[model samples]
Structures are given as structure tokens and as C-alpha cells.
Target: MTKDSSPTQLTHFDQQGQAHMVDVAAKQDTHRTAIACGVIRMKAETLAIITEGTAKKGDVLGIARIAAIMAAKRTSDLIPLCHPLALTRVHVDFSITTETNTIQCQAQVETVGKTGVEMEALTAVQVGLLTIYDMCKAVDRGMVMSDIRVLEKHGGKSGDWVSLIDQQDHN
Candidate 1:
């Protein structure tokens, strides 16, 4: 297989075009932070059960919050190419939107390491939503998760980036 030597080439591929983890050994250690967000929509009754803490599973959001933080720390284990990072902080937040019968999850992950924590943040958001689904599935199996994305990332050689959708919302 031929390799793309272009600067824009995918980092996970080597000169022989084989998939491998990027070598960050030469990279400088910087304080990196990433934020990710997603939303899960469910039936109004299910949302009510979650908000009112009436679910049979017990304290849905509280459990999911813990699950998200754990997911962030374990992200490298789940994704093959990801580096195991020593995270300095992981913060997860959930907001209920009664108008849309949805719950939004956001995660902020930080690490003083060579690579950014984008994957950790994204993983945390996804796992948080999954935990919510698992706890409430009996009442709302049709719950849908959507809009999982990295909202912003700071640090690294390439510098900072913010999703266009996120920028528009703030504007």
C-alpha cells in the first residue's frame, strides 16, 4: 500500500500505509482540553421519570455522570489507536430539555500530555448517553441519541479548533 506523505495525511497510518498509533514521543507535553456534547431524546414519560428520580434503576443522571467520567479515563482502552492519557480533569454535565423531551450531555476532558483529549471527551458524552438509555430503556426503548461531536479542542501542535455548529450557537 502506498502512503500519503502529505501533511494532511491521517496520523494513524504509517509510511507503509499500515494502521498504527501515532508516535507522540517527540511531541511536547502541553495542557490539552476538549469538550464534547450529545443529546438523547426519549418519551415525555421517560424524561419525567428521570427528572423526578422515579426510575426503577435509581438516580439515572447520577449514575450516568459517574459512567461518563469512567468512560473518559478508559477511552484509550476502548479505541485502538488512542493513547492512554493521564487525565487531569474530567467533568460531565447533563441538562434536561422538557420542551423537546431530550437530555443533553456534555463532557470536558483535560490532560497534560502530548496528545489532545478529544477522544476522551467524545467517549464520555457517548457513554453517558448510553447509560441513560440503559437505565430508562424499559420505559422508552425508542429513545434516540444524536449530535455526538467534539465541540472544541485546545492545545497540541495544530492549535485550537471549535466546531462550526458550536460557534454559530454562540454567535
Candidate 2:
């Protein structure tokens, strides 16, 4: 294995590299929730078009919300490592901050499962943000996607972690 390989490579996969999914069956089924976020950066004018619901592609937030929810529910199908989970609930919130001229998409995924919901949450946000970029590309071809990350995670063996990005604002 290369020195730059991820720690996950050392822990999860075997030497045969058959790509087996991790078994969380022995782990306790705890209520888990993960909040993931991503940003869609575009021209100020393009944002105004989204804000005004004037985009020819239709309701930006509405489509993004549905996309995120659907992505969360289908996480197992999209990623091989993720376990199929009966998610208790999924919530996606969209906010546009004029200060940064960016659209922030946040996905909160909740479930009572042996494995965590971080991947589901992250996937939802990524797809949702990408959908936005696709929809608005005609107006802003240079749209940039950035800062796709988990903002918070809870109810797992590792306990909880809140992103330093969130903590920095509080201090």
C-alpha cells in the first residue's frame, strides 16, 4: 500500500481486495443524525434569478430539496460501502447568503441503524448542490462547487463532531 493511502484502506478492505462491505451487524442500533453541507458559487445576478424564481429551469430550491431526499434514500445504491438503511427522516434546507454570493445546501439525515448516516447526508448534499449547478449553468457557466463536507455527526461509536467551520463563528 502507498504511504499516502487513506487510513480506511488499512482498516476496512482485505489484502485480496475483493471490496467487501463492512459488517455493522454487531454494532448497536442507535439513533443517528448527520448534517452535511455544500456550496454553489455563482454570479450575483444568477443568484438573484434563483431567488426570484425566474430561472427558466423552474424552482431551484424545490428541485434541490427533492433531489437531496431521494439521494439520501438511495445512498446504498449509489455507494458500495454504505449499508442499506431504513432512514427515519431526511431534511434538506437551502439558504442563499448574499454576503458570499453563494447558495448553501444542507442535508440532515436521521436513522436508527448500526452504521452511521454520514455518507447518506454527504451524498444528498453533493447531488443536491450539483443539481443546482446544472440547472443554473446556462446563466452562470462558471459556477463553482466547493466546501462539500459533513458539518456535524452524532450517535455513533465515535460520538459527535461539529465542524470547525461552525465553531469558528461562535468564538
Candidate 3:
């Protein structure tokens, strides 16, 4: 699709309006990468427990990282219309901000395939935050997850795209 194409165009729908996987067979295989990020905020005390490794559950960040990677690999299985692609790499990282009592999860998913890895990266972030909440819910049930989004994406017919929030940071 070109940049001039209708913004409302839904690639997953056919002329009959039936949901179907977009035909990517004609698309070239390229090195596609997608970076997604999100943050989960909690009480100061809960953050302290996590940072100090005093939570009843073992390492919170470690478990969440593993869950994020697993979620990336199984993205197609979870999302009905996603095409299954062999991911070349899945990297999940977490950063804790004591001042805000928040943990940020970033996932970068890459693949050489007809389509992009945006969905996989996004799935990883969501699952990672969910895992963190699961591990720490006992201590802080009010933990809030926000700012979930694809930071950037590269390759594919549409070419590279970066979220305006990230672009502004570079400038």
C-alpha cells in the first residue's frame, strides 16, 4: 500500500468484508524489525519489594522477560489473523523507575519474512506487563499498565515508520 492510500483501508478485510489473512505470498522476504514498549505502575512499597527481590514469587523481571519471549514466539497462535512467521530474534528488557514506581517493558522482535513483526513485538510487551501484574498483584492490585505502543518498525512494503513520540525525542 502507498502512503496516499486511504487511512481507513483495512488490509485484513476482503471486498466482501470477510476477515482474512492478507496475502503476503507476493511480498519479498526482508529483514523486518519492530520495537514495542509499555509500562506498569505500582505502589512505592510494591516497587521496593520487586527491586529488593522480596516478593513471594521469584525474580519478577526474569519471569516477565521469559514470558514476553514466549509470547512473541506464539503470537500467531494467539492472534487469529496473524500469519505465522519464524522469528529470527526476540529480545525483552525491563527498566525500573523508583521515582514513579513503574517498570517499563520493551520488546524487539525481528524476522526475515513477507510480513512484519509488529504484532509479535506488541504481543510481547502486553504479555510481559501481564506477567509482572500476575507476579505482584498480591502486593498491589491497583498496578496500572499504560503507554503500550510500537515505538518503531523497519522493512516491508510500507518501509520504515516511527511513532511520533519517538521521533520527537530524536529531534
Candidate 4:
């Protein structure tokens, strides 16, 4: 490949700068996985409402879990540059921290495809957190979403990559 056609160049644009899908047909399929995380900070009372399962909208975590899975599957529809992928596995997790008055959302997405699933994982985490906000917004509209990021990814030519921030927190 010529230096002009290096993969580092933007993949979502053609020579004319028009938008187009990156062709992955020639790329080898590999087992790809990505994990993303984010947090929603809210009032303590709002957190109590969610924890007690009395938000009037029913179960906050349950609804958020479903939303995250659905969002991961429909990622291509939401993000124009993302490719439609047949995901093999998708998991969404949530934790509530009283100290921070925060709800943390994490999503792990896996697929055997040519492209990475970082976008899918990130989308899932974001949608999951949004669902929480929507369900609890009636009681608390001041909630803030922050630290949305990909925690890790593996497979493809890039191999494995992990976020140092997440690692440090765990340690």
C-alpha cells in the first residue's frame, strides 16, 4: 500500500472527502471484545429512589440493562460510521456507590468480525446510563453523566489495549 493509502488516513472518507463505509470485506474476521464504562452522578435522594425500586417507572437497573443490550445491537443505526455487526455476546453491568452518589455503568461487547466493538461497548454504557437518568429524572433532573470511556479492547491487528485509568483505580 502506498503511504497515501495508509490505514492511518481517515477510513470514513473517500478521496473526494465524501463520507462512505469502510470496506471490511478483505479483512480477516477475528474474535473482538471491548469494555466501556461511565458514571451518572445524581442526588442522594434520587439514588435512594433507584435503589429502593420506587421510582414509579419500576426497576431502574433492569430497564437500563435491557436498553444497553438493545443499543449495542442497534449501534450502526445510531452511529453513521459504524458497521452493522452480528454480536456474539453483550453484557451490561451497573453499580451504585453511596460515597459518590453515582451509578456506574459498564458494557462488554464481543463479536467475530473485521472491525472493533469499542463503539458498541461505549454506546451500550452511554445508553444504559441515559436510561437510568430517564427513569429517575422525575425526581432528579440535575444528574450529570461523566467519564464515559472504553476500558479495554482485544483482537484485530491492534491486539489488546487497556485504559491505564481503569487499571489504576482497580489497583
Local error of candidate 1 at residue 101 (angstroms):
0.4
My TM-score estimates for the predictions, one after another, are 0.95, 0.89, 0.94, 0.93
lDDT by residue for model 4 (48-117), tens? 9989888899999999999999999999999998999999999999999999999999999999999999
Candidate 4 accuracy as lDDT: 0.94
Compute the lDDT of residue 102 as modeled in candidate 2: 95
**Candidate 2 lDDT tens digits, 28-48:** 889999999999988999999
Q: In terms of TM-score, how similar is model 3 to the real structure?
A: 0.94
Cα lDDT computed for each candidate against the true fold:
0.94, 0.88, 0.94, 0.94
What lDDT is obtained when candidate 2 is compared to the true structure? 0.88
The stretch of ten residues in a row with the least summed lDDT in candidate 2 is 1-10
lDDT of 1 by residue, 11-102 (tens): 78776888998878878999999999999999999999999889999999999999999999999999999999999999999999999999
Pairs of residues at least 3 apart in sequence or in different chains that clash in candidate 4: none
Question: Which stretch of 10 consecutive residues in model 1 shows the poorest summed lDDT?
Answer: 1-10
Model 4 worst lDDT window (10 residues): 1-10
Evaluation by lDDT, superior candidate among 2 and 4: 4
Q: In candidate 4, which residue ranges exceed 4 Å CA deviation? A: 1-8
Off by over 4 Å in 1: 1-7
What tens digits encode model 3's per-residue C-alpha lDDT throughout 39-154? 99999999999899998999999999999999999999999999998999999999999989999999999999999999999999999999999999998999999999999999
